[model samples]
Target: MATAFYSHPDCLLHEMGPGHPECPERLAAIEDQLIASRIAEAIERESAPLADLADIARVHTRAHIDFIERSAPSEGRAWIDPDTSMNPHTWRAALRAAGAAVAATDAVIDGRYENAFCSVRPPGHHAEPARAMGFCFFNNVAIAARHALEVRGLARVAIVDFDVHHGNGTEAAFAGDERVLMCSFFQHPFYPFSGADNQAPNMVNLPMSARTPGTAVREAIDLVWLPRLEAFKPEMIFISAGFDAHREDDLGNMGLVENDYSWITEQVRRVAERHARGRIVSCLEGGYNLSALGRSVVAHLRALAEI
Candidate 1:
């Protein structure tokens, strides 16, 4: 069984600005590292398709979908927030990003691949049911989880978000939904601060302080996330694989390293193997430092591919 790597050229066309951290180079960095690290040929690469409005609507409101479509600028940038913006290609790029997740989910479920990784841009996990923020326009992982449940009739799924910021949008989409379980850790008192205050039984959101090290994050995952995931016994696993928590990434103040990400992927893979028949769909989220992002993603892929 091989890992499916999903990406598209449209993802490169959607840029916030000239020097924004979440630039198209982020994907290029990943590609460069994949080739440099010899992981490119180990996985199967697939171009992402445009996500259908119905699939996106499984997690986002129709009004929100309409707004995103209407928000595309013809020739200039349109600001969604202070840190987020859109160009003419943003709408299609966002759809492809979400579509990669959905398609990856189906591939994993159908056993076409052992697991998958979606390396698309306009990284999701921040776009709420009706609001877009934090450099995201749609909740990609959330939509994929919904597809696994609503379309595939899976009874349970687990969402693992390791981004530096809280997945407030994903939480908004499935906070009280018992069919889904979301586990995450993020920098506290940071951008889009909300996970620490959440008390949902199905959500295991750990808010670590700014400078928290990887050891602490690992402890929390081992003691908290793994136990809950084991108990829930999800039929499939979805990972919002963000690398901004890397110590070198200036986007946030966390102390995780490439080895930490590899370890985290291994842990997640173990759980997936145990409960989900090794069905995992991981999507790229945040990691601004190009070098660190590239290295971290390669490490993650190595772990997922067991290479």
Candidate 2:
């Protein structure tokens, strides 16, 4: 089976403001790369459905869920956080973003696709069960992980987050749960500095200093993430894919280039093959710098699709 590409038109409607780093253009950039690289022709493209409330409730509290449904502004944009805002369309976009993850999870796990990539936005790695921050309204990957376990009945699941910032919300949701394993690396001195103090043994947190390169990130993969992932033997693998660490992106200083992301995906795929029957669902998290972000994502998708 070919890799599946999950996206929705509503995704572009969830804009924060003018000049925000995590803007609507990030999705356009990736789409441009897929077209330019001719990668778009190779995968199955599908529109994402609005996530079921029951499926979303698996990761979020009922109160939090009700709050978001009511938080969407009727007219002008309403601020949820300093960088996060919502208009009338934002609620539907959040559901589609979360839905993209669920659809990808289903495609990979049910053998309908070899792997899946979600290009929806209002990126969700930083959204907690009860809080929304970092431009995220819902914890998409966390929602998918819980659904894969509770709905699809997978015994174990693994999440690999290589975002510029830690998936603090995800770590909080699944921490100490034992059913899920989270391995992540992010800029330590950056925003939302909490991954370093991982309260859960299942959370393999790696913090990098400014200007750290792929070599250091790779070392972390070899030393910390891989061992735990292999030991967990996840029935399904999920990735919070973020390209902001690329050298051209102003978000974080990891000095990573296109090849670094490709290399990491290769290793992630290998682990999935060994442990999870090659089942993987990757959700978009962060990527700025349009050109670099585009190329980096193409490299990542190429590796995932084995193209």
Candidate 3:
């Protein structure tokens, strides 16, 4: 089977604000690029299902889900925090975002597809288990990893996050749990700065400074991620793929180009091939700046699709 593309129209309905960086247009930009680049025709696409409470409960608490559902504003908007807010559609969109992950995980693990990529958003990596912040609500990728381990019966899985910011929520959910191994590289001293003190034994955290180049990232992957991944021998691989670290993106001070995304994706592909039967389920986490997001995601998906 081809690489599965999982997304939903409701994901676009989760509007933060009119002038917010995480606007609804973000999804449209990605879809436009994939269609224009012919990437859309080359894969299978599925509209994301609304995630059940049980599926989300795999990562988020029942109380949290209840709070988010009830937190929707009747007229205007409700602020979850200074950074995160809920419009009426935010709750449904977050459910579909997490649902896409669950579906992608099933596709990769069940031989339904060679691999999968979740294109839904409110960018889930920064969402903690008990807290919602940084434009995320449900820790979608973390839920996927847990589902693979708990429901799909995978013994070990590795999550490789190369977002501009750390996946603190994912780490919070899976920390101290040896079933999942995580290796991530993100700009330090950035938003939600926390990876430097990662508490998990299987967690390999690489914290770089702002504007760090591709060379520096390659060094960290070579010196850090690969060794730990080889030793762990993960049965499955997941990517918290974020393109905001691209040189053209203004969100972070990083200077990576589209080729940088492809380079990292290629390296991760090798690991999946060698250790996990080329099975990878990637979920989108962050990337603003329409042009950069489009190009970088195209480059990333090209690597995933082997085209």
lDDT of 1 by residue, 1-307 (tens): 9999999999999998878999999999999999899878899999899999999999889999999899899999999899999999999999999999999999999999999999999899999999999999999999999999999999999999999999999999999999999999999999897988846999999999999999999999999999999999999999999999999999999999999999999999999999999999999999999999999999999999999
Q: After superposing candidate 3 on the true structure, give the runs of residues whose Cα lies further than 4 Å from its correct spot.
A: none
lDDT of 3 by residue, 192-224 (tens): 879897356978999899889988898889999
TM-score for candidate 3? 0.97
Instruction: Give the CA lDDT, 0 to 100, for residue 75 in model 3.
Output: 63
Residue 92 local lDDT, model 2: 96
- The TM-scores, one per candidate, come to 0.99, 0.98, 0.97
Q: Which ten contiguous residues of candidate 3 have the minimum total lDDT?
A: 193-202
Candidate 2 residue pairs in backbone clash: none
Highest lDDT: which candidate? 1
- TM-score, cand. 1 vs. native: 0.99
Backbone steric clashes in candidate 2, count:
0
In terms of TM-score, which candidate is strongest? 1
Where does candidate 1 clash, by residue pair? none
Candidate 2 vs candidate 3, lDDT winner: 2
Scanning candidate 2 in windows of ten residues, the lowest lDDT window is 193-202
The Cα local distance difference test for each model comes to 0.95, 0.90, 0.88
Displacement of residue 74 (Cα, Å) in model 3 is 2.9
